[model samples]
Target: MSGGIHADTAPKPVGSYPHARRVGDLLLLSGIGPRIPGSDAIPGNRYDADGRLLHYDIVAQCHSVFANVRAVLEASGARWQDLVDVTVYLTDMAADFAAYNAVWQEYFPDPATAPCRTTLGITALPTPIAIELKCIAATGAGARR
Candidate 1:
């Protein structure tokens, strides 16, 4: 078993974690924040569809949060189809539940490609960040091969 999938190149890690790591057949990713690439500032915590900030709407945060997930996967030379499992940690479950699912569907448009998932409600996260996603993906050269 090759048990390895190297990135084309590595990006600057966000915090105290590697961007992604390959173990055996699995590519494991750390939780990504709402910050976009090339910037340290995180995205809006809450905003409307039209880009108006909303104090109580967490839907906006969920979108950016998942976008960050996509960024990490792309940087690691994988796609959403390679994903086998996901673990989501949320600080505010009630506010984020609906937003999470709706935005998730947008990214994971195909039900067949959907990964097994576990979403947990927690009291707090690293920042006031409402959502964070960590994922496991099997690469073609490894298990998916």
Candidate 2:
């Protein structure tokens, strides 16, 4: 629903789906990566000459992905504070967990107000990005569309 919600300011979805969809007061966002808008460039990710990822900064990816999530939420007529739950996926948990957690605390400093979170260490993602976020936000019913 929500008329195939799309955030023009955010990076394009890797697949054939809208940025988000609304069901009742909940807005469900698709997987959001740390790619730069328009170029799909992953922040802090260094690629080799053959386009293979050489290394990445988890802090940069964390900030970028969070910003991307905010864009989707705001474009969907919601705010960052409206987020109720988030599921994070990372390719290398053991290597990235501490840095990612530090970055997370920077954005969500208050545990009382921060959304419920679940982090999963996966094998890979569609792009070379190291992190991705799946979010659910609560929004009002009014759509100025």
Model 2: residues with Cα > 4 Å off, grouped in runs: 141-145
lDDT of 2 at 95: 95
Judged by lDDT, which candidate is best?
2
Model 1, position 107: C-alpha lDDT score: 77
Model 1 Cα lDDT, one tens digit per residue, 39-92: 544555466799554653467677776666667678777776788899988877
TM-score of 1: 0.76
Residue 45 lDDT in candidate 1: 49
lDDT of 1: 0.69
lDDT of each: 0.69, 0.89
Q: Which 10 consecutive positions of candidate 1 have the poorest summed lDDT?
A: 2-11
Per-residue accuracy of model 2 over 21-60 as CA lDDT, tens digit each: 9988889999999999889788898888998888998898
What is residue 120's positional error in candidate 2, in angstroms? 0.3
